[model samples]
Target chain A: MPTVELRFAALNGHVRTARMIATAVSRCAGVPAGAADEIKLAVTEACARAVRVNRRHAPQSPVHVALTETPDSFTITVADRGQSGDEVAPGPDGGLVTASTLLDLEPDSAAPPWWSEPAEEESEADGGFPPGLGLALIEGLVDEVQISRGADGVGTIVAMTWHTGPAVAPSDSIL
Target chain B: MDLSLTTRQEGNHTVVVVGGEIDVYTAPKLREQLIDLVSGGSYHLVVDMEGVEFLDSTGLGVLVGGLKRVRAHDGSLHLVCTQERILKIFRITGLTKVFPIHSSVEDALAAHE
Candidate 1:
């Protein structure tokens, strides 16, 4: 299958453009309206996280986004060239803290009372991760998620897949 | 896309109508407006995001910050968002539980009363 790829500087402003391109490509690939919205949000979060991660560790590196349409799903891969140390590092108590773990932090009591408390066991299952709402949002919007280190042993790669229909493999190829 | 904000008085509430995309680039604009409204003693705020074409984590952060700002003064902040796309962002971040989201400004104001 053919893939659509985009490369841009690791900057906050670029996330919008990445989302626009992802939406366009998803639409062209015949993704449904509701699923297209999911793709848009999921891709935006992925790209934004990549840009932020790159800026923190490898300011000069660029963020890369690739979109591929398979028979049963649309896959988006966002990769950055920044170090992934903090995501995998141990916490002060020698326990692993994952992205979901960071989200488990309690909201300030004096602040708004509506902020919901995190589920206790959620973070421990995912391991130590980044401290933000981005990853959690991506997980909610997509069907499958895989986080891994880049092939070059630097940065992070977030691969998200949204199933277009039932999980069965297509009898015929669309691409 | 760029972001634009317009404010109007609806009875005892201040209604802020937001337009365009709300992402990292445009979130600061919304943040500044909310900050000004809170610091200026206008606490009962209803943000109408029906015109928002896009929303990301940055936008979510600003809304959360605005809620905290208003709550500090014993005031309240409500959201008027009907778009599923926009609503999905709130739901995904678990903000739906935090924000008093209404389908329209009138509904939000009515609830405020």
Candidate 2:
């Protein structure tokens, strides 16, 4: 097996570098071209989430990304040294403060469009859209996903695996 | 890595041509542009993603936010994307059903009209 590890500041800008490294490693590990895209996006999401969490709780910490290639699959693990909350919480103004809230704060708008209403319902049922969509996308793009607390229970680790074969068809249940 | 955004008006719609990768780092720029457009009363938007090489959750979130902003004003946001890799992100996130996506600028404009 071959492994690669990287540690970088928990900033949004570093997410792109993380994705680039994942793409390069996956390509070198013989991951199919189509699956390479999935790996890139999944890793990017995981790193982005880690950055957000670290920024919220431990601004000085760095995000750690590890990629390992086995004979059967490729594995990626993104870790953050921030306080991990399993659920997305609303800010004081009743708006979500998850990854989506990284955008500038704007006045609350009316209900989302009809097509997007289902997503809001799904978010309510699953907690919220930030973690919900990010994890759902990772699960949809990869063969397996495992989220766990970091050693010593200080932060979060998002580990995803992709088999060395054809990519799975994306499921409609992601929404 | 680098993102460039240019806007042109076609009748009642504002078409934004975006070029480059959109990730956590660069998404804020796109977000600011979209918000400025909506605040300026250019509610109807068509974003051309054909030149986009990469998009992640942050980028997607920005688009969703833009959509909500425009929808609040009884306006609409459409996406022009042909790259399978970029389209796959929208499909996986189930945003394909949320925003009207077209393969070409012409198709997007036609649909908006």
Candidate 3:
């Protein structure tokens, strides 16, 4: 099937766009409204994080979003051009922790303040903020979420899949 | 998100009509409105949630906080929750017991009498 693709500069104001994308995906997949919202939230978080990283690095790069729907499932990919410079080391820091917490990951653990945390060495990492909550949310809301660090180490790709065709329970236990 | 507020001198009541999503992004707006109402000495607040599409924890926090604030002024806050999805969130959070929820705005508005 033909995929849906949209590219826009990553910014807080565009977060709502993710919702629109998710709605399309859900409609195509025949998923529930709540599930559709969850998918939208996850995509928005991931896209926002990518945009944040891009702003910190390139400062002017735009993020791209692609939604592909098949007879059995739907997939979304959020990608941004990676940052270039003195690679900042990654670790259990504030931003990543914040994202994780928002995504309801990390169990009962709270991340220590970033200032007090030790920084690890940086690898050939792409541009993106820490708070891995986007990852967690993608994982929670979908059947699968995959990350692709571009071979050139110049971009990051986040892909999520809804395999059950989007029929989500209307009312969850937690409401 | 949209919010509309109106007060009437019906025996004893100050009603606030809220229409829109009550999520993390919109809760602060509601909080500000509630603060102004209470600070202006308008009590007996009634919140009409009939038009609300969603209500999350942040939204719940504002309601709880508003309830506490109004009660401190020797006043009360009533809610009109007609949306099943919104009500489910309140019920799951056990807020159905904390706030007096009615079926419609007219029913809640008439509560002052």
State candidate 3's TM-score: 0.53
lDDT of 2 by residue, B1-113 (tens): 68889999999999999999887788778988988998899999999999998887778877887887787788899999988888777765557767899999899989866
- Expressed as tens digits, the lDDT of each residue in A1-175 for candidate 1 is 4479989999878888988899998877766666766787788878877877787888888898989998767899999887764343344565333323334433543543333322122222111123445766776777787778889887878888877766534332111
**Clashes in each model (backbone N, CA, C under 3 Å)?**
7, 0, 5
- Best DockQ among the predictions, by candidate number: 2
Q: Give the clashing residue pairs of candidate 2, or none.
A: none
Q: Estimated TM-score per prediction?
A: 0.81, 0.81, 0.53
TM-score: model 1 vs. ground truth:
0.81
Please give the C-alpha DockQ score of model 3.
0.05
Which is the better candidate, 1 or 2, if ranked by DockQ?
2
Worst 10 residues of 3 chain A by lDDT: A119-128
Tally clashing residue pairs in candidate 3: 5
Error of 3 at B41 (Å): 1.3
